[model samples]
Target: MPSIWSPESDTHITAQYSQKTLDQKVRNKSALQKECGWPVEAKRAMVCLPLGMTEALGGQVFRSMLPGLFTQSMELLILGKGSKEYGTLFTELQKEHGHRIAILPASEASVHKILAASDIALFLANVESSPEVRACLSYGVIPVAPECDTLENYDPVQERGTGFLYAPAKNPEQTAWSAFAALARALETFKFPFDWKTIQRQCMESTK
Candidate 1:
């Protein structure tokens, strides 16, 4: 069974996509066009990038990460100055692959809202007992972070078993790739009762 870890401070809640969100996904193409500015040819769906991660963790490694992750047609909505700083690395990366990624700038909460819209929140925080991870899980956003044994807590991605875990120190760029692969594996092979899916579902239900 996969286990998801929560902050010791409070019980985590499990949340479903809000009715307002469902309405938009179902009825508001024009709104999405204006808001997200997706190309008419591109799919409207996009992965969310959270604000805190964008701010705290979107360092040099993050700048180097985009081209690999967004090689496919994809977009981003970064919630801080971090995205702007992300430019230099992006520009360098564009020398190899250009104009295929979109970035929307805003505040952290907006990023959180976008993250909530996502299947999961991909982030890295060396800190253990993270409330951010707990909050995201409650909202149905699985967290993918590099695993650090020195951090002295169970791997959130492994323990909560809702997301992915990588050890960048060990895996380098392969770390992110591993997380994505882990996500695919989870979606395909996820089990319940004896798995993290049940735990995440219960967390969401209890939160309601």
Candidate 2:
């Protein structure tokens, strides 16, 4: 039987997995953004951090990187539930960044919508063979994750691989920095539409 994620499958899937044309992808993204109450605009990269929110899930590390990641050209969407303190932190950050940052409950529907609309899936926690990572790839959302057996580190020179990966660090500060650097690289690549689309396509193809 064909995998459900495969384009050949009978399952109805989002544009991210449907091998859509560029125009179709843009239209779908715009519609999803409007549905999610996000701004529908050109030249803005949508980055999503989904799943549980807690210290163990890298909530603190993500907080530390907010100043650097929340740029004018980027919009962040965070979803999940965990830790009242971390929830407050993200709520405060959302206020500070205005529409550039949004926090949403991690309902299955919301998570699926964000994954379909996002340009990048930001994973700050140390994860190996994570289902979340696979889900992002299936949705054509390029990921920035720690180096792991499950993901292939993107090779810009060769224009290959599924996503970006940084080596995990023992020190918390160093780990944050490494993750930041990897995300920075993804943001830089986002500047070039053709290259970014190539990577997105690669991500989708990987799951098949």
Candidate 3:
């Protein structure tokens, strides 16, 4: 069991096991990616981890973001071995969005390599600070997680220009729509005359 840490203010939810080990893991994985010469210089918004440890967290939330993200030429890399529950859905999504989406399980080296190739790491789950978020920061990949009370202290995403924050939805059907809108907001922030590289450097520098 992995343990996920949240802000002390949100004591209502108990710590989960899987995401607790994410921070250090991100650091290590990012280092490995650098050592292996994987590049993390792209400006694409890539939503990942559904096929692996992050599966089932977002439910149907991610499905709605495909159209928007793909239109922007952003690549969504869903790594890890997907659970049986989502196998069919994943397959269908892959077929429909394979032009910009990758649905498959990969090795650690491969995972790091993929991370190195990403820019924004999207989170559709209720996670305030997931290991994937920490990992993204380590690789200079900005994190875009849901906005909620539990993450009141997580400033990176909440603060303007550092990252994007979308409100989380309670209804399962609304989850996808909320996530898509949030991601759209995030895309707007990353687009245009905005200096993405400079923002990336700033974000990396601000990380502890």
Instruction: Give per-model TM-scores.
Output: 0.54, 0.86, 0.63
Q: How displaced is residue 27 in candidate 3, in Å? A: 20
Give lDDT tens digits, candidate 1, residues 1-208: 0123222222221222432222222122233334544454223333444543444563534544555566443444343345555555444544543333334355443543454444445564453556555565655444556664322222445544445566565444565565555444443333321354443454454334
Instruction: Provide the overall lDDT of each model, using Cα atoms, as 2-decimal numbers.
Output: 0.43, 0.74, 0.51
After superposition, candidate 2 runs with Cα above 4 Å error: 1-17, 20-23, 35-38
The parts of candidate 1 lying over 4 Å away from their true place are 1-34, 39-45, 52-58, 87-104, 148-160, 174-177, 183-208
Model 3 per-residue lDDT tens digits across residues 1-208: 1122222222221221112222222333344334434444334455555224334677566655555556664556666465666666666777776555665456654555555545567777765545656555545555666774323222334443545567666774576666666566656655642355545555454444
Model 1 vs truth, CA RMSD? 8.3
TM-score of structure candidate 1: 0.54
Relative to the true structure, candidate 3 has a C-alpha RMSD (angstroms) of 9.4
Off by over 4 Å in 3: 1-45, 50-55, 64-72, 148-161
Instruction: Give lDDT for model 1.
Output: 0.43
